[model samples]
Target: MSRVESAVGVAFAAEAPVLIVGAGAAGLCAALAAIEAGAEVVMLERDPVPRGSTALSAGLVPAAGTRFQAALGVADSPGLFAADIQRKAGGEADPATVDAVAAGAGPAVEWLADAYGLPFSVVDDFDYPGHSARRMHGLPSRSGAELVDRLRDAAERAGAALLTQATVTTLFAEPDGTVRGVEAERPDGGVERIGCRALVLACNGYGGAPDLVRRHIPEMEGALYFGHPGNRGDAALWGEALGAERRFMSGYQGHGSVAHPHGILISWAVIMEGGFQVDAKGERFSDETRGYSEQAAMVLKRAGGVAFDVFDERIAAVARQFEDFKQAEAAGAILSADRLEDLAALAKLPAGRLARTCSEVERLKASGGTDAFGRTFSAGQKLVAPFKAVRVTGALFHTQGGLAVDGSARVLRPDGTSLPNLFAAGGAAAGVSGSTAAGYLSGNGLLTAVVLGRLAGLAAARLV
Candidate 1:
């Protein structure tokens, strides 16, 4: 039950077939695949099973141009998906890398639905901003926790042993520079060594570590991190210790949420659907129609990624229209106010300036002025008098940058050479979205995790 007992040092008579660091989506998938391939696998997790960011995710998986989409009469191709990624990444992503992900995405999604029983549902005409096709998928349960539960079951049924609350302290390497295993510290202050012929790092990103952010990204100079507390850059540290190539440490995805007194991240998916984001003076800023990632980036760059959600009694009345609004309010994600002055005061904005800005917004609504994106407002009439304000801060949803890996999910060194006996996948592997302007591609993250994990598992099984 305790981390120390779970990870108490016991050397394997010989190296196990595969040792996966982190029992998140990537690690669980890799362990299950390796075990299914008749290889012995051990998975170490810093947190308990069925917990962590993977469980906390929204679990949107997008595999564009697949046979499923084609069956649904949706027109798409891996090439088009790759091209979109390349364009969004500003030509920073390697073409081969993007192609590899797109190529395996279809199979990976199918495997999740069929092999693991992920309860996926096909959604026609579901639009992901900036993408040409409607290729987004979601769970019928509509909760990431449900998907993670299924993954945990699959991994266990496949004979993968999961050790929770076990933090890998260092990767053990042979003299020839091949990773052999890992050393970990258990929650009970015990040291444990797990030896294996191959090591896979799926430990995710360092978005929660302010020190790492300050060192790698100057833009986040004073920005508060809004990711999982356990994401302290341990994976990045271990990779760096082995001279692994790193990328996109400076870039991170931002979330629009209410930062409560205790720093809890309430989902912005609510505000986006119900209310509008405004600046300190209560004026609309940035394109509201932009993708969540793009909006987060803009807010981070311009307004420090913090704003107030301004909504009137009508908008509040219609709050039940969005599931996120109800959940956020239930979870105390939204701050409330009755009058504009009191709302401004609670949101720490100048009352007079906020009132003036709101008045201007009302006039613009009446006259149909241009919106934040220069688009003529059609919903201006919805802005009735007596508005409410909720203070929202920027939160990080997931990390974009990670270890440099090849198409096969092999971790490459700085010189583009493969790390011996070492592979990476999931958020721990890099070169996915940092180069693309369109942030996330729906199921891109989870799909990549499953695909790269299977590849790593199969490849590790072949290693001597």
Candidate 2:
């Protein structure tokens, strides 16, 4: 399956001790770690910039036992974090890999903050569905674009050369499945054959690939893909050609609350903070708090492919911290009114049914009783005057499944043996979310990116 000769007299255009494909969070973090470990690094990016799915995310990374967590007097441990991952994943995830990522995540966050000067702080407010503690850490903006920009600047400052608009189209590997180099095509249709002692596949997963989504995740085949267009499953294809193991091809991160028409993501914090969703018929459907990822199919199947997220001014204030929410508000996606009927009229929803839904929600909160959907409305603060609503639709963010790797982030064969000098991270590797979207806990994507990227970089640097 090799497209180029592995050991023949091929003209080499460039070389590096460590070569990484794709310049997303994984590639940038790997470059940082490799440079810190005294190895020369080169990164190839298909786009003009380093933003991938990372830019589309909220930029939150969950960790255990970090200084940020301790500073807030929140007690957490890696063991507890691993347990939470397993429980959320239905015990289908690999125990060893879960343990390794849980252990490395905190240290990776600290390293990025202390060594690279990325301002990191744990979110102390609402907790994501499955996390036991408020361990989500992010930059001040709480936006993935900020995180990617900071990481890119840090990598460049550390002397890691980043080549943008360089698309790696083919791999040069030996018959024994040992990768030796790659052929990258330039925008002008020129090709460059680059050699490397070690290679890292950080190109991300296949959410943008309609054919792959139809073949694997058929449930979300025609859904809106909100991930990076450059995530066309190049890493998964290369891994297959190199005889590397692949797993959990159906797993993905699906969101139910992307502001439709505006294309801005309404933060799930709204729902976590006493907001509820109403379908076109103005009826509450499903337990929204089960997980945002699983809410995608629910919104699609039961909500006539669109729904309205209803919240109050208090919840809106909490959601205002997210950059996406502010963007949504600025784009006029957020409809507001002092009265519920007027707010429903503004969103073109059924006034009477919407009122009934709110009344039911209030009843649940007042009585502290579980609704028919198994979701309990805690007797917390009630939603007061000035209501808010947004039109939302489900979207596929990215795939969580790809090439399978070991604890060190080395690509593995079907028999569980490592591929020589080949590693995968981020969306390019099977994630800890098991084999479905329901198993996804918040921040799982960034966790794998930082933790496995750091491990892959350190291990690859050792080989050089």
Best by TM-score: 2
lDDT of 1: 0.67
Per-candidate clashes, comma-separated: 8, 0
Superposition error at 77 for model 1 (Å): 2.5
TM-score of each: 0.81, 0.98
Candidate 2 per-residue C-alpha lDDT over 1-464 given as tens digits, one digit per residue, 9 for 90 to 100: 11434645566778888999988899999999989899999999989999999999999999999999999999999999999999989998888789999999999999999999999998887878899988999999999999999999999999999999999888888778777788999999998988999999998799988999999999898898899988888889889878888988999999999999899999998998888999988899999999999999899889978999999999999888899999998999999999999998999888999999999999999988889999988788578889999999998998999999899999999999998899999999999999999989899999999899989899899988
lDDT of each: 0.67, 0.91
Model 2 global lDDT (CA atoms, 0 to 1): 0.91
As a TM-score, model 2 comes out at 0.98
Residue 187 accuracy (lDDT) in model 1 = 76
Task: Itemize residue pairs with steric clashes in candidate 1.
Answer: 61-443, 62-443, 88-436, 88-437, 89-435, 89-436, 89-437, 255-395
lDDT of 1 by residue, 1-464 (tens): 11112213345434567888877778877887787677888888888664666676655566766666877888987788777766666677766678887777777778777877776665552354556776666666455666677888889887888888888776666545576666778778997877788888777777677777667655555665655677777767767767789877655555554443435443333343334677776666776545556566556666666777777656555444333455666766555666777877777888888777667656656676776575444344455556565666655566677888888788888899988888888778874677332455445567667678777777777673
Error of 1 at 213 (Å): 0.7
